[model samples]
Target: MSFAGFEDDIGGWGPPVELPTGSGDIVRDAMRKEQVIKEILAAQDDLRALLSRVNAVQGDVDKLASGNATLQTYIDNLTMQMAKRR
Candidate 1:
């Protein structure tokens, strides 16, 4: 026998059985929760990317500071030589 164009199997393993109407709401709630989890994961990925960029900028700043300190030492040595010649 067939109902709604689906043949019923004697072993009760035919097409999927329909859920109760009230269960539909539960399924929707579960799907919504899954969507929220996905959004939270995406936000975490964005934060990680931002942190990586900040770290890169900090490394660049450190290099510039080191270069500046080296230049200042060279200038100080030149000033001392000029003063000795005076």
Candidate 2:
């Protein structure tokens, strides 16, 4: 008998795991381990995606900062010109 494609056998397609017969404790432990592994993999994938998004936003912030510096320089120059006109 197999649950979630994990056959309770000696030689199988997936990794050979010996499960206890009629021992609900062992079976429950295996199921919990499988669930934890799946969750960990999902979290890893999510973290990678979040990191990529953060890097992209950081690049945009750098561009915005560069533009802000250029605008500030232009404003300073305009202020000097207005003072000379007075």
Q: Rate the local accuracy (lDDT) of all candidates.
A: 0.89, 0.90
- Candidate 2 Cα deviation (angstroms), residue 35: 1.5
The clash count of every prediction, one per candidate, is 0, 0
Model 1 Cα RMSD, Å? 12.7
Predicted candidate 2, C-alpha RMSD: 11.5
TM-score of each: 0.67, 0.64
Q: On residues 1-86, what C-alpha lDDT tens digit does candidate 2 reach at each position?
A: 56886656646576867766645688797998899999999999999999999999999999999999999999999999999999
**lDDT of candidate 1 over 1-86, digit per residue (tens):** 46796655644666676766645588897988899999999999999999999999999999999999999999999999999999
